[model samples]
Target: MLGDRFVYVAISTILAFSYYILPQKNEHYPTCPTVEIYRPLNYSENKDILDKIINDETFRNSSLYKMQQAIRINTTSFNDDLPLDVGNNLDKFQHFTKFHNFLKDEFKLVYENLQLNMVNHFGLVYIWEGSNTSMKPLLLMAHQDTSPINLKTLNQWIHEPLSGDYDGKYLYGRGSGDCKNLLIGHLEAIEELIKIGFKPRRTVILSYGFDEEISGFRNENPKFIENIYGPNSMYAIVDEGGVSLMNVGETKLAVVGTAEKGYLDLSISIEKQGGHSSIVDKRTAIGIMGQLIVEIDNNEMPTYFIDKNPTFYQYVCLAENSIDIDTKLKNDIFNSQIDQNANENVRNFINKDKYTAYAIKTSQAIDIINGGEKINALPEYVELMINSRVAVEENITIAYNKFVKDTTNIAERYNLGLNVQMAYSDEIIEVIPATEMGKLTIKPITMLEPSPITPIGDKHWEIFAGSIKHLYEELAYPDSKVVVTPGLGTGNTDTKHYWNLSDHIYRYRPGVLPSVNANSHGVNEYIEFDSHLQIIAFTFEYIQSVDALDD
Candidate 1:
C-alpha cells in the first residue's frame, strides 16, 4: 500500500511541475497587423504619376532642389546686419520677409491671423492646409532659425558650413541637422504626395517658428494655436524632440518623445563683509560659495524622486539586460557589499557614456562662478550659476527649496557665514495619459519617469515588433530577443508645447541611432545616407499600415 501511494504522489508532482514549466497557449496574445508587411506599391504601373511628381528630373531638381539650395544660405541669429535681438527688430523682419516671399511663390502659403510681437524680435506664421476637411488635421512643425555659431568657428569647416554642399549623400550646412533637414523633408514629402494625386484622408498642416533658437517664451505661439485650431481639435502634432537610432549595444530603438523636462536657470548669490586678502577671515563670500558648490557636486538628488512611469520604465527594463552585470548590480545595489562593489564596477559604465548615466541620475552642473575681481582683494559678493534638468515628478519650487535648505545646513556645519538665495526657476512639465482608437493608447510622458510596462499582448506592440522584424532581419539581436518598446529621451525638445494641448503625442523618428557620436547640438552632425533611404521606405510602410486600420 505504501509503495503504491508513493508512485501515485510522484506522478502527481510530475504532472503539476509539467503544467508550471510548459508555456501556456493563449489566443488573446496579439500578432502584428497584416498591413506592416511591406508590399511595394505598383510604382512600375504608376510610373507616369511617380515620374511627374517625384522623379521628373526638372521638377525634382527645381522646386525641392531650389528650396534645398535656399536652406544652404547662411542665416545665423547673430548676423550684425540681421540680428534677432529686440534692438534689431527691423533686421529680423527683413530676414523673415525674404523667406516669406520665397515660400509664398513656391508653395501655397496662407497667413495666420495672429502676429507675434517680441521685444525686439518678430515671428512669422505660414500654413499649408490639406484639401480634406472631414478628417482630423495633423501638424508638422520645424523651426526656421539657427543658433549663432562663432564667427571664428564658421571659417574652420572643411567646406564652408553655410555653403550647403551636396556631396550626393549629405547636404553639409549650418542648419542641416539642427533641423533644416526636417523642414525640407516635410516640404518634399508633401510636394511628392500632391504630385501623385494622393490626397491624404486627414488634413496636414505645417508650423514653422522663427524664434525657436532664442527660446519661444516671449512668443505668442499658444495664442496662435488658439486662433487656428479653436482649442482641442488637432489629432496629433510632430516636432523635433527625439530621433530613432541604434543604441550603444547596436540595438535599433525608436525614441518617440512624449514629454520633456522643464528648463531651469538658477543663480546662487552669497554676500559677506569684505576684508583684505592678506588678513584672511574665517568666513568669506568666496569661501561660502566654494563650499556650496562642493556640497552640490558631492550629493545627488534622491532616487525616490524618480517617477517610474510606464513609458520610461519599459525602456529601462529592456536596456537593463544589455548593460554589464556588474554595472547593473551597482546601480541597483542597496546592501553594503553591493554598494562597495558598485563604486568600482560602475566606473566603466560611467566612463562609457557620462550623459546617459547622468540621465538615469540627476545632474547639477555649475556653469559660471564669479567672485573676486582683482588679485589680493577679498570679494564682497560671490555668484554661482547652476543649470539643472529637474525630473518632471518633482516640482521646481521643491527642488529649489531643497537646494536652499541643504546649502544653509552645509554653511552652518562649516560655520561659513553665507546666505543662499535662488534667483529664477521654472516648473517641470508632467506627462498626461491620452486615449486613442480602442487598440492604441499614447501617453505624453517624459523620460524622467522609468519606462512603463505595457502588456506584451497589446496589438500596438505586436505590430511594431512585426514591422521591425519584417523590415530589418537583424532587429532581433543575439538570441532572437526583440526589444520593441518605448524608450526615455535624455535630451529636451519642443515636445512639451504639444503635450500641453493633447496627450496622444509620440516621439518617433525612423532612423538608426548613431554609433560614432552624439549628433544634436554637437559638431559634425550628419545622418547616414542609407538611413535616410530606409526612413523614406519606412514612412511609406507606416502610412500604409495606418490606411489599413479597421474598427
Candidate 2:
C-alpha cells in the first residue's frame, strides 16, 4: 500500500498532465422527457428578486467574502483512535465552535429568526417554523468539516490551504469545494429570504454535521433525525453529493442523485504462531494475508446493468440526449435489458470509463493492513481490511458472500479454521480443525445496504425537478435547455442516516460540468465563483417551490 501523501501526489500528478479533450458533437440525438411543472406562484416577482440578488455587486462580493471567511476556519475532521466520549479527543473540535460563531455573526437574521438546537455538541440544527403544522418540512443538509490537508504538500499549493484567497475567478481554499461552500450557501439563501420578507408556509430545516468527512456523524448516538425530527416527517431532503450539470450539445443534464451505493469494510484477521527469523513455518501470517489480498484483487466485481438501478436510468437519459456517444453504443445501452448480446456490449463499454464502471459494479480497494512487530520475527497475527462501495443493485450479504467464495479454497488448503456469519441466514459457519495450526476470521467493521430509490414522476419529484429546471433556465444557463434526470451517487453522504425521513430524498449540488475539476479532497481545492452563486439561487427557489405544494 502507498503512503497517504504518495497517493495524493500521484493523483495530483495524473490530473496535472491530463489533457482536456472535448467530446465530438452531433446535432440530432434521442433525449429523455423533460420535466414540466408550473413555475412557483409569483414567478415574475421571485425572478426579479433572484436577478437582483445574483447580479448585485455588493451581494456577490459579500457572498464571496462569507465563503472566504468560512474556508479560513479549518474545521478538519479526523478518524482518531480515541472514543467519542473521551474529552481529550473532544478538544480537537474547538474549531467547530469558532465556525459556529462565524455563522451566527454572518447570518444574524437567520440566527435571530429561526429556532436553533445543537446535537452531540457539534451538529447544528435550525428550524424556521411555518404557519401550517400538518405539512411535512423540507430538510436541507451540509457538513461543516473538510478533509485534512497533507502537511508535506503544503508548499505545492498555489495559495495557502486556509488563506481563503480569491484569485478573481476561483475561491482558493481547502473547504471551497467539499464543502463549506455549501454550508455558507445555505445560510446565505436563508438570510436573503429573511431580507426579502419571504416566510414559508411549510417549515424548513437546516442540518450541519461537523464530521461527515471521516464518517463520524453516522455513528453518533442519539441520531439527529430521531431527536430533531421523527421518522417519515420530512417532505424531501437535499444533501451535498450529486453530479455536476453535464453538457449535452445545446442542452444540459441536471443529474439528481436518487440513490447511493452501499458501504462495507471487511477485515480479514489471520492468527497463527510466531517464531524467530531462522525457524519459520511453511507460511507466515503475513505471507498468508498477502496471498489472500492477491486473490481478492484478481477477482473484481462484475459490471452489469440493472433496469431498476438509478444509474441505468441515467444512461437512458444519455442515450436519448447525448450526441457524443457512438450510435451503436447508445442503441446497445438502450436495449441492454432485453438483449443479452447488447447487455454484454454495454457492459464492455462501461468498463472503458472508470466512473461508469464503478457505478455499475462494487468498487474494491485494499486500504489497510497490519502485521508483525519485530523486524526479524515471523508474525503471529495479521489483519487486512478491504473497503467496498457496494453497487445499488446489491446488498451487504451478496457482497460478503462473494468475498467468502473467492477465498474459501485458499483457507481450506491451509488447514485453517474458518469463522464466518452465514449469508442470508441467522446460522453461523464455524469449521474447527481437530488441532488448529491457524484460524481465519472475516467480519464487517461497518456494513450498510444500498439506499432506497426515491420515486420519480410524482408530485414530490415534480417540485424538486421543477425547482432545478427553473434554477438553471432562469439563473445559470438561460440559453441552454436544462433536463432533469435521475442519477446515482457513487459515494455515500450524511443522507444515509435520514433514509426514513422521506422517500423523496435528493442529493444534488448545482455545479457545472467543468467544475468537476475543482480538486475536491485534493491539493489546490477551489470552487468557481459563478457555481457558488448558482447554489444560493437554487436553494432560494427550491424552498418556495416546495412550500407552494398543496396540503
TM-score of each: 0.68, 0.88
lDDT of 1 by residue, 115-150 (tens): 222222444443444445554555566766676666
Report the C-alpha displacement of residue 344, candidate 1, in angstroms: 15
What TM-score does prediction 1 earn?
0.68
Instruction: Give the number of colliding residue pairs in candidate 1.
Output: 19
Q: Which portions of model 2 miss their true places by more than 4 Å? A: 1-33, 81-89, 218-229, 247-251, 279-283, 421-428, 432-437, 513-517
**CA lDDT of every candidate:** 0.48, 0.79
RMSD of each: 11.0, 11.0
Task: In model 2, state the lDDT of residue 231.
Answer: 81
Task: Show the colliding residue pairs in model 2.
Answer: 30-320, 31-320
